[model samples]
Target chain A: MKEVTVGIDIGGTNTKFGIVDDAGTVLYQSKLPTQKHADFKDYIQELDSAIKHGLEQTSSDLQITGIGVGAPNANFYRGTIEHAPNLVWKGIIPIVDIMQKDFNVPVIITNDANAAAMGEMIYGNAKSMKDFIVITLGTGLGSGIVANGELIYGFDGFAAELGHVTVNPNGRNCGCGKVGCLETYVSATGIKRTVYKLLADHIEESELRGISFHDLSTKMITESAERGDSVAKAAFEYTGKILGSKLADSVAHTNPEAIFIFGGLSLAGDLIFAPTRKHLEANLMPIYKNKVKVLPSGLQNQSAPILGASSLVVDHLNKKSSVNI
Target chain B: MKEVTVGIDIGGTNTKFGIVDDAGTVLYQSKLPTQKHADFKDYIQELDSAIKHGLEQTSSDLQITGIGVGAPNANFYRGTIEHAPNLVWKGIIPIVDIMQKDFNVPVIITNDANAAAMGEMIYGNAKSMKDFIVITLGTGLGSGIVANGELIYGFDGFAAELGHVTVNPNGRNCGCGKVGCLETYVSATGIKRTVYKLLADHIEESELRGISFHDLSTKMITESAERGDSVAKAAFEYTGKILGSKLADSVAHTNPEAIFIFGGLSLAGDLIFAPTRKHLEANLMPIYKNKVKVLPSGLQNQSAPILGASSLVVDHLNKKSSVNI
Candidate 1:
C-alpha cells in the first residue's frame, strides 16, 4: 500500500511515464508514441490510458500522490507549455489543470532540462551537489543550472538556455538563428560537422573514410572509438576539449562543485572524459584549477527522466503538505 | 525601544560598523584603520570597543538583536574568515564566536558581495527581484549571484567568483595568477590598463597625452568622458561593451531579472550604462533579448554595507526561528 506518484517525461517523438514511490523506486513504467496525433488532445488521450494502466497494476489501497510532467517550453509558474518548438500544439496547453482534474491531486510541470537536474539531485549521482550544471548532449545540447539548490528561471521563466550561448562567435550556425552556440559544437549535429571539418583538413586514413553526415550516429562513433578507431576517437577528444574549456570558464562564474554529463553523446566514456578533464584543468583558474570534478550521471538511462519528472510531484506535494500542516 | 543589529563592513584599509534598525536606518556609524593591527585579534578588540560605545549611546531597553559582519573571504556556513587576501590574518578567523560572546545574541557573517546582493534584495531597488547579479566593479570585480531568492553558495561556499572568469584568454595579467580574467579589463585597474593599451596602439592621441597606467585613475577618465574627451570616452565604451557581452553570456547561463552595478567604478552613470545596455541587448538570445533590465543599486552609498550586513541576521533568525514557540 505504498503511495505512488505518476511522472511523465515528454519528448518530441515519444512520451514516457512511470509510477514512483517515496524512496525513489519505480514500480511501473511505459512509453508511447507522442507525435502520432496532429492535435494536443489526442496525446492527452494516450497519456490517460497509460495512467489508468499504471493505476491498475498497483493495489487498490495504494494511495496516489500527484502528477509531475517534464516537457519542452514548460513553464512552472504559468503551468503551461508555451511555444513548445517540436510539438504540434499551437498554443499554451493548460497541462496542470487537465492533470489535476484526472488525478485529483497537485500537478507540477517544468522544462526538461530543469527536471533532469532535479532528478539528478533527488535520485542520481548529484544528490549532495548544491551548485552544478547538468549537460545533456543529445540531438541538441540542453543544460540545467542548479544554484543555491533551486533551478534558475529567468524573468520570463526561460533561463539556462546554455545551448544558445555563443561558444565561438563565428564558428557554427545554430538552428536557433544564432552563430556559434555551445550546442552547435557539442551536440550530435555539432560533432558530425566537426568530423567533416576534420576529415577535410587531415589526410589520415580511417574506417570513417567516406561516411556522410546523414549515415553517422553518436552510438556508431562511440563503438568505433571503443574498437580503437582514430577518427571516432578524435571526434570525442575534440568535442570534449571544446566543451571542457567553455565549461571551465563557466565554472569560474559560479564555482560549482562538479559537472554532470548525460544523454547520447556523453556516453563516449574515455574518449570524452579524458580530453574534457585535461582541457578543463588547463583552462581553470588556480582557485578552481583542480577543485571542480566532472563526472557522468548515474541515473539509469530511461529511468532518469521519469524520476526527475516524479521529483516535481514530490517537491510540489512536499511544499503543499508543509504549508498546510 | 525597538531592537537593533550591529553591522560591520571590513575592507583592506578601513573597517566600518553601524547600528541599524529594521528600516535600514543607521543610528550611529564609525570607521577605524584596519591595516594598523598585526594580529587579527587586535582588530577584534578595536571593533568591540566601537560596539560598546554605540550600546552605551542608547538605553538598556534598546535590545541588541545580533551582530552581522561583511568581509572578504567570509563564509556563512563556517562563520569564519577563510584566507582574506587583503588582511594579514594568518588563518581562518572565528568571527561569529567573538561577536556572539560580546552581545549575548546571534551573530552571522558572509562575504561582502553576498551582503550587497541581499542588501539590494531586502531594501534596495532590486527588492522584488529573485534573479539578479550584483557586480562590485572596483579594485577587482566582486559578483554576488542571487537565483530564486537565495544567494548562491556552491558545495564548498565558493560560488559566484565571476571576477576570475576568463574573458580574453591571453589579454592581461590578474592578481589571481590568471590571464584575461574579466577583472583584468573591467575593474578600476582593468579600465586603466585598457586606456594604456589603447594609447600604445594609437598613432594620433592628444588628450590622454602623457598618462601612465599608475597616473591614470578611473575617476579621472570618467571625468574626461563627461567633458567630451574621446580617448577617455572610448575606454568606458569599450569596457562597457566587453562587460555587456560577457553579461549576455552570463544571462544564457542563469537568466536574471536584472544585473545591478555598484561600488566605485559604477558611479560613472551613463558612461557605463549606455554601452552596457546596447551591447547586452545586441548579444542576447531572441528569448532574452531586449527584456532583461540593467540598473544600479538604490541603497545609499554609506548605509548599503551596514544594512546588508544586518540582513544576514534577519535571514538567519528567520530560518532558525521555532515553529510552535
Candidate 2:
C-alpha cells in the first residue's frame, strides 16, 4: 500500500486538515470552524471524523504513516499548546495525546513557524541550505531558526521566539507583557497601527486617515500603497526599518544563508521587501553585508501552511525509518 | 606511548602554546610575543619554534596526536585568520596550513571564543550540557554558541559575533563601525568607558575620575568597587543592565541551559555577577524566567584559554577516531 501522512494546521478561526502523499501532494482536504466546539473533547471528535472522511475520500490502498500538526503555541517536546492567547480554548491542550488516542498513529506537534521552517528545508527554497531562518508575518511575527542542518529546539523546545525580542526598549507593550517586541511593530496588525501613528504625526493627505483601527485591514493599506498613499508607504517603510534592523541582530546569532519571509505581509512583495532589504544591508556588520539574502516563500500561499505542517510528518517518518535501518 | 595534543592561543600581544592531554591537563607551556615579528612568515617561524620547544620538554614516549590553534579571527572551514583588527597580521593568514605543514598532525583553527566553548564542553561546567553560550569579556566581548552539542558555524565560518549585536542603536560607536554594539557596553574596554561616563554624569566623588582612559583597567575598577567606590559600582551595574537586556534577546534565539562568562572582566566576581544575574532575570521572557543560569567559567583564568585552545585537538582526535571505528 502507498504511504500517506495527515497534516493539520490549527488557527484561531479555523483548522485545515489534509491527507498528503510522500511527494507533498494533498490528496484530500477539509476544514472545521475551531470556535464552534467549546469543549476540547467535542473539537477532537469533530476533527477525528473529518480526518476519517478525508481518509475515506483518498485511495483505499493508502496506508496511514503518521500525523503532523502546526498550532500557535504548540510545544514539540510536550506535544501541548500552552496558553495561546488567540485560541478559543484556554490553557494547555494536549493535542498529540488526544490525536494519538483517536488515530492510533505517530503524532507530532510544533509551533506553526517551526513547521514552516521544516517545510522550507524539506520542500521549499532551503532544500539544499544548511543554515537559514524563516519569518512568518501574520497576526504576529513568528520565526523558525535552522542551524547546522538541524532545527534548533533549544533547551526548552521553544526557541526562536524572535517576535517577542525587544526592538526598542520602550517601544510598545506586548500581550506577553514585554515592551518593544518585534511583533508589535512588524506584523500585519502592526502595520495598521503604524498607519494610524503616521496619520497622527504627519498632516499628509491620505485616504486611510478616516478608517478606524478595527475597520483598517492590511488589504486596505496594501491597496492604499498601490495607489501611492504617503501614510501607507511610510508605514511599510517604518515596519521594514524595524524588521530589517532586528534581522541584522538575529544574523549575529546563527549567520543563516538567507531569510525566507512567509505568510500575509510577505504577499505585499517588493513594497515590504524593498525597505526590509535596504535596511537589512544598512544595519548588517561589514563582513556580513550583502552576504545574506531576504527572499519570499517559494511555496504558494494557500499550500505553504499545509505543506509546512505535512513536512513535519515526512521528517518524522524519515527519522523513524532511518533508525530502524 | 602517551598521546598528547598541542593547543595554542594566539593573541595580539602574546601567543600561549602548550602541550595538553585528553584529561585537559597542560603538560608544558610557553609564550611568544606576537607583535614582535613584523612579517607573517617570521611570526609563523617563531610560533613553530615555540611549539617545537614545548614538545621537546615532554618525554620522548609522548605521541603527538593533533594541534589546535585559537586566534582572534580564525575560520574553521578555511583554516585561515581573516581581517582581525587587533592582530599584527592585517589580512588572511593560513595559520592552520602552516602549522599542519610544520607539525605533520591533524590541525584545526577556530576563533578564541569557539575554542573557549569547546574548552567549556570538554573541561568546564558544560561537560554534560548540550546547549549553552560562552561570553568572554576580555579586551572585547567575544561569544561562542553551542546548540545540540555542536558549534553553530552558520553558512560562513563566521557565526556567533555576539559583540557586534546592537544593544543600543544610539549608545556608543564600536570598532566594528556599528553603533551600540553589546561589546561597547560590556567588555573590559566597555566597562572602562562606562566608568568615565559615570564619573562625568554623577557628582558623587570617586578616585577613578582622576584616571585617564588609557591607564584605566578592569582590575583597577574591580579593586575600586571592592573599596566602596560608587562610580565603579555604577559602571558595573550599567554594564550588567545593557548586557542582561541584550542577553534576553539572544535567549529568544537559542534557549541556552546556561551562559558562562569568562575572561578579565568576569574576574570581578559578584561585582559583575550580581548585577548581571539580577538584570538577566529581570529582562527574561515570562516562560524563561529564572529557568536559565548565569555562571562563571569552571576553568582557571590562566588555564581556561589554553585548555579551550587545546580542546580543539582533543575534539579533532575524538572525531577522527570515531570515524575510523
Candidate 3:
C-alpha cells in the first residue's frame, strides 16, 4: 500500500492540514479558522475532525503512516507548544500528546521554521546537504538549523532562534525587550521601520513619504524600489547590510553549505537578495568566502508549508520503527 | 589489558604529548620544542621517537589503542593541518596519514578548541551536558561548539570559529583582515589593547600609564587588578561586557545549556566570570533568562588539553570497530 502522512500547520488565523504522499504530493487538503475556538478543547475537536476528513478523502489503497505538525513555539522533544504569542492558546499545550490520543499514530511536532528545514532536507534543495540553514522572513524572522543531517534541537529543544541574536547593541528596541535584534532590522516589519528611518535620514523625497506606517507593506516597498525610489532602495540596502553581516557571524557557528531564504520578504527577488548576498560575501572570513551559497527557498508558497510539515513525518519514520497508530 | 590512548597537542613553541586511559588519567607525559624542526619530516620523526620512548615506560598489560592530535587549522575529515599561521608548517601536512603509517592505528586529528570541548565532555563539567559551548580566551579567543552531544563540524570541517565573528563592525581592525572580531576585544591580546585604549581615554594617575605597550602582559594586568588598580579592573569589565554580549548572540544560534570559559584569561576567575555572567544575563532574551549557565572549565591547566585530545581517540573508537593498528 502507498504510504501517506498528514501534515498540519497551525497558524494563528488559519490551520492548514493535508494528506501527503512520500513524494511530497498533497493528496487531500483542508483548512479551519483557528481563532473561532478560544477554548483548547474546541480547537482540538475541530482539528481532529479536519484531519479525519483529510484521511477519508485518501483512497483505501493508501496506508496512513503518521502525523507531523508545525506550530509556533512547538518543542520536538516534549511535543508541546509553550506560550506561543501568535496562537489563541496560552501556556504550555501538550499538542502532540493530544493529537496522538485521537489519531493513534506517531505525532511529531516542531516549530514552523524547523519543519521547513526538514521539508527542505526531505523534499527541497537541501536533499543532499548535511549542514544548511533555512531562514523564514515574515512579520518576524524565524530560522531552522540542520547539522549532520539532523535539526539542531538543543537541550531545550528550541535551538535555532537566529532572529533574536543581537546585531546592534544600542540600535533598535525590540519587542523581545532587547536592543538591536537581527529580526528588528531585516524582517518584513523591520523593513517598514527602516523605510521610516530612511525617509527621515535622507532629505531627498520619495513616493514612500506619502504612505503611513500601518499602510506600508513589503510589497509596496518592493514596488517603490522597482520604480527607482531612492528611499525605498536605501532601506533594502540597510536591511541587507545587517542581515548579510549577521549571516556571516552565523556561518562561523554552523558553517552551513547554504542559507535558504524563505517567506514573503524573500519573494522580493533580487531587490532584497542582491544586497544581502553582497554584504554576506563582504563580511565573511577569508575561508568562508565564496564557499557558502545564499539561495532562495526551493519550495513554493502555496504548498511549501504543507510540504515541509509532511516531510517531518517521513523524516521521523525513516529513522525509527513505525508506530502502531 | 588496560587500553591507553596517546594525546598530542601541537603548539607553535612546544608540543605536549601524553598517554591517557579511558578514565582520563594521564599515565605518561612529555614535551618537545616544536619550532626546532623546520622540516615536517624531522618533526614527525622526533614525535615518533617521543611516542616510542613513552610507550617503553608502559608495562606489557597496557595496550595502545589509537592516537589523537590537536593542532591549529587541523581538519577532522582530511586529518591535515592547513596553513596554520602560528606553526612553522606552512602548506597542508597530512599528519594523521603520516602518524597512521608509523603507529598503524586510527590517528584522528582536529583543531585544539574542538579537542578541548571533547575533553570537557569526557572529563570535565560537561559530562552531563549534551549541549554546551567552550570559549578559550588565550592569545586569541577560540571556541568549540557541542550541540546534541556532537561537535558541529560544518560542511567544511571548520565550523566553530567564534573568535572571528564580528562583535563590532567598525570597532577594531583584526589580523584576519576583518574589523571588530570578538577576539580583538576578549582574548589576552584583546585585553592588553583595551588597557592601552583605557590609558589613552583616562588621564587619572595609574601604574599602567608607566608600562609601555610592548612591556605589558596579561599577567601584569591581573596583578595590577589584584592591587586594586581601577584602569586594570575596567579593562576586565569592558572585555567581559563585549565577550558576554557576543556570547548572547551565539546563544541565539545554538541555545547551549552552558558556556564554559577556558584558557589563560579565564584564569582571572571571578574577575572575568563575574562581569561576563552579569552581562550575559542582562543581554539574554526573556525566554532564555537564567536558563543558560556560564561556568569555568573544570579541568585545570595541563591535563585539560591532553584529556581533550585523548578523548578524541576514544570518541572515534566508541563509534567504530577496533582499528587494525
Worst 10 residues of 3 chain B by lDDT: B316-325
**lDDT by residue (tens digit), candidate 1, A248-271:** 767866778888888888777778
**First chain of model 3: TM-score?**
0.97
* lDDT tens digits, residue span A109-139, model 2: 9999999999999889999999999999998
Model 2: CAPRI class = high
fnat, candidate 3?
A: 0.83
Model 3 lDDT, residue B115, Cα: 93
Point out where model 3 deviates above 4 Å. Answer: A321-325, B321-325
lDDT (Cα, tens digit) per residue for candidate 3, span B49-153: 998888888656777899989999999989999999999988999999999999889999999899999889988999999899999989899899998888889
Candidates' TM-scores? 0.96, 0.96, 0.97
For all predictions, the C-alpha RMSD in Å is 1.9, 2.0, 2.2
lDDT tens digits by residue: candidate 3, A191-280: 999999988877898999899999999999999999999999989988888899899999999999999999998988888899899999
The TM-score that candidate 2 achieves is: 0.96
DockQ of 2: 0.81
Evaluate all candidate structures by whole-model CA lDDT and list the values in order.
Answer: 0.83, 0.88, 0.90
Query: Could you tell me which residue pairs clash in candidate 1?
Result: none
Candidate order, lDDT descending: 3, 2, 1
Per TM-score, what order, best first?
A: 3, 1, 2
